[model samples]
Structure formats: C-alpha cells, structure tokens
Target: MFIAIFSIIIVLVVLGALFINLSPEFGGTISDSQKEQFSKSEHYKDGVFENLGGVTMSMGFGDYVKGLKGFFGPQINTRPKGAVPINALDALELANYKGPARMVWFGHSTFLYQSYGRNILIDPMLGPVPAPHPLLGGKRFSEELPIAIEQLPQIDFVVLSHDHYDHLDYGSILKLKDKVQMFFTPLGVGAHLVEWGVAEDRIKEMDWWGETSFEGFSIKCVPAQHFSGRGLSDRGKTLWSGWVIKNDGANVFFSGDSGYGGHFTEIGEKYGPFDFAMLECGQYNKLWHEIHMMPKETAQAGVDVKAKVIMPIHWGAFKLAMHPWTDPVIRVSDKAKELNLPIVTPKIGEFIYLAEPTSNGGVWWKNVD
Candidate 1:
C-alpha cells in the first residue's frame, strides 16, 4: 500500500514538471546575464524583484482558509448575470483620429490609446481567460473585444507592465507580434517577448525611472509596488512597473498593478499634475491588500498623482476577488466625490476623449446584476 501511494505521488510530480516545461504559456526563462543586469536595480535583491517598502503577501494558515471560504463559499453579484456591454470599435474613426488624445478601455487594464495617428496598446490582454488555460480562470465577462485583434491597425507600440498571466497573455502576444512596431517592457519582461519570437532589436526593456523616446513622445518606466510571476516557480523573477507617457499634447500615467504605497507620492512629485491617470481599483481583499489597493485608496492615489482626471480600471472584466462586480466603481466614485476628484466611468470600449472628459454614460453598472 505504501509503495502504490509513493508511485502515484512520483507520477504526479513528474507530470507537473513536464507540463510546466513543455507549455509555451509558461513563457521564457531569464538568463544568468539577464539576472545580472536586473541585479543593478535597487528593487532587485537576493535574485528576485522586491516591492517598495515592506509588503505582506503571505497569509497565515487561518487567513488562507478564510480566503478559500470567501472565494468558494456563497457569494453574490460577483459577475454580471448577462454579457457585459461593450461598444464596437469604429476602425475608420480610429485611423482618422486627429485631435486631443483618445483612449478606449477594453475592460480591466487593457487599453488602446491614440494620438495624432499613433496607436499605443497597454497591457493588451484580449484573451478569453486570464490564466494560461481557459478552464483555470474562466471566461472574461465580455463576450467580445472592442474589435477583433486581427482588425487592429498598425500598432506603434505595445507597452507591458509585468509578466503576470492576466497582464502579459501568451496568446495575445502571438497574435500581436507581427503588426507591432516596438515593444516596451520593464526589466526581465522582454525575455518572454524574445522567447515568443519578437526580434531583439524591436524590444526595449527599461528599469525604474528609465527613459526613452519615440517620434514625439517621451516614455518613462516608473516604480510600482507590485510583485511579478507567471508560472508556479518564477515568482518575482521579473520586474513590475507603471508607465509615464508624455508628449507635446498631453501627459499620462498608468498605475499598472500596484498596491497603495509611497511610490504613488514619489511618482507624483517627479511627474505630477498629469492630464489623465488610469489607476487600478479592484481585485482586493484584506488577506492580500498590500499588493492590490481597495477602492478608496484608488481615489486617493489619483490625488497623490495630481491627475486632472482619473479613470477607475482593473475591474469590470474578471472576478478576481470576492466583492460584488460593481463595488469598485461604487466605492471609488463615492470617495472621488468626497475628495472632489473628477472620475470617469466609461463603458467597456467607449471612447474617452481626454480634452472633453464627460461621464454622460451615467452609472451603467447599476443595472447589471
């Protein structure tokens, strides 16, 4: 009986190893040279990326059980009863766009930002599931993207914030590689791009505070209090970060997947008074609050960054936490009102023209169940 059980355990272990190594979705391996290069960043210590300040990510056994109960136990309104509403992209309008910068949120953190004919895609996770396998993460809330990936115009840039499965999807990259002109990612993230067939010259990896330029835009990779990993064993092997995009027309900030921390203040001081900001405002619980901000903090982060207007993102697409689907916008909107911060809640795929910001699509989620 002991030998039979031992054999079963050994077989399982071997199968798991084989699956991780053979799966393309697991992404690329970081070379020793890449590790040495990553070692220069203050955030990289002891051979792994570290968040700013002390962050508590590990939960005690009791907390772990409680989280499991909260996730699997009876829950209400975690997802909408029907398909999420989304606007179909007018490709002609996007191609001929010539005015103040416009953005279309494809739910969650994915966005298509257009300015003067240049198209930038940020965290373009257009897959149906956020996990490597569909069965693991379930389908996205929306039935379709703003537009089909194949129909996208020539992409000027593809910006990535990290290597997490939701933010850096394997299938999306496979579809986007051919049309994308350049790919910008934080340190250690470009390795995955290279492994996935993107040419080395077309990828530019940056450290925190690193700056680069393209055409008329100045792009900077900024700090974020977040962790990174895609597979089971590669946690923190790559860096995570936010981005600051500046041009003659506008200045923008993307808070990437960060927890509430001093980095927000630092980013504000360095590049404050942004014309627009997209801040993460969902997938949070007390058990893992240090890595994901609650809704109130999301509003305050806007103030810290001195954004003229803020948009609440990282919700509306997936049920990563136990809260109701509408809780993020509700809580963040209330806090923004108290703070007197202008917040926009555009429907999935709706065009948000930065110069003429409006919340005319009033409280759309109130009807979703």
Candidate 2:
C-alpha cells in the first residue's frame, strides 16, 4: 500500500514537471542581457523583482496546501446562468469616431482606450480562457466577445501590466502582433513579447517610476504590490506595475492587478486628480490578500488615487477565485457608495466616454443565476 501511494506521488510530480516545461503559456525566460537590465532597477534584488513594502511571493507551504484544497473544493455560481450580454460596437465606427477620451471594457482588466487621436489597448486579453490551455483554466464567463481580435482597428499601442497568462495572453499577443504598432511593458517583460514574435524595436520596457513619452501622452510606470512570474521557477524574473497615462487634456490611472498598498497614495500625490481610474476589484481571498485587493480596498484605492471616476475592473469575465461571480462588483458598488466615490459600471463593450461616463446602472448580472 505504501509503495503504491509513493509511486502515485512520483508519477504526479513528474507529470506536473513535464507539463510546466511543455506549456507555451509559461512564456519565455529572462535572458542574460535582460537579467543585467533588471538588476539595474531599484526594485530588483537578490536576482528577482521586488515589490514595494517588501512583499513576499508566497504565503508558505501550509497555506499553499490549503489553497490547493480550496481550489478543488466545491464552487457555486461561478458562471452566469445565461449568456453574458454583450453589445458589440461597430469597429469601423469606433475607429473613425473622433470623440472625447473613450474606453470599452471587454471585461477583466481588458480595455481599449482611445484619446488624443491615438488608440491604446491595455491588457488585451481576448482569449476565452486565462490559463495556457482551455482544459487547465476556467472558460470566460462570456464565451462570445463583442468583437473578435481580427475586427480591431489599427492599434497604436499595447500596454502590458505584467507577464501573467490572464493579462499577457500568448494567443492574444500572437493575433495582435501585426495590428499593434508599439508595446509598452515593465522591465524584463519584453523578453516574453520578443519570444512571441513582437519586434524588438516595437517593444519599450520600463522600470518602476520610469516615464516615457509617446505622441501627445506621457506614460509613467508606477509601483504596484504584486509578484510576477509565469512559472514556478521564474517568479520575480519580471517586474509588475500599474500605469499613469497623462496628457494636457486628461489623465488616466490604470491599476494593473495590485493589492492595496501605500503605492496608491504615493501615486495620487505624484499624479492626482486623474480624469478616470480603472482598478482591479476582484479575485481576492484572505490567503492571498497581499497580492489582490478586496472590493472595499479597491474603492479606497480610487480615492487614494484622487480619481474623478472609479470603475471596477478585473471582474465579470473569468472566475479566478472561489467567490460568487457577481460578488466583486456588488461589493465594490456598496463601498463606492459608502465612500461617495463616482463609479461607472458599464456593460461589456459599452463605450465609456471618459468626460461624461454614463451607464444605465442596470444590475445586468443580477438576474443571471
């Protein structure tokens, strides 16, 4: 009996190892030159990227075991009862519409922001599953998107927050390679893009607190409380960050998968009064609280960033956590009301005009069992 159990454990271990090595979703490793570049950043330490507040990557082995159990435990209401409603925008009309700074949230931290005559895509994760393979990950709540990747207009810029599969999808990047003119990512992340066939010249890698100029906009890589890695051994090989997009006309702050931390107030002090703030407000658990923020903390993050309007993102698409699918937005809505913060809850593919952001305030997901 003992031999049988031990042999089974060995087989499972070997299979897991093989899978990690074989999965293309694990992405590319940091080259020696990339390592040298990463070492130059203040955030890089002990041969890995470090978050502010000296955050540790893992909770511990015991907690990890608990997490694994929780992951396989029974989950309820993960997917909506019916097809998630989608309002497909006319791609051609959106491309030609010269209007105020507008954005269309494709759900779960994916959005296309157009303003100042440039089209920018932030975390264009159009893939149906967040994992490397559909068999390994939960399917997106809404199977059909408003528009397919081929339907997108000429993308001027692509902003990547990190190298996570959900945010930096290998499939999506491959499809977008020809359409996108430029890619901006944190330090060491360009390695993955380069591996995936993005031109080296088209990719701009920046460190935390680094700033770059593109067209009429000034893009700043800001700090976030999060760890980075696509695989077990490669944790912290790349940097993670939020972004601040500012121009003479308006400023936009995008919280790219960060936990609640002092960085919020710091960013607000440096770049306050943003026209809009898009923040992660989902996929949080007590065990991994250091990596992802709760809904109330997400609202406070908006206030800390001094945003004129706060929109809850990183929800409504994939079920990366055990919580009920609608728990995130519902909690955030209550928190925003408590804090008296202006919130914009737009339906998927609905264009959110930044200047006068309006949603029907419909609890569209409520009726979805």
| Candidate with the greatest lDDT versus the true structure | 1
- Candidate 2 residue 61 Cα shift, in angstroms, is 3.5
* Backbone collision tally, model 2: 0
Total clashes for model 1: 0
RMSD of each: 1.5, 2.0
Pairs with steric clashes in candidate 2: none
lDDT of 1 at 254: 99
Q: Which residue window of length 10 is worst by lDDT in model 2?
A: 360-369
lDDT of 1: 0.90
Clashing pairs in 1: none
Q: lDDT per residue, candidate 1, 184-269, as tens digits? A: 99999998999899999999999999999996889999988889888888889998999999887789999999889988989999
C-alpha local distance difference test of each model: 0.90, 0.89
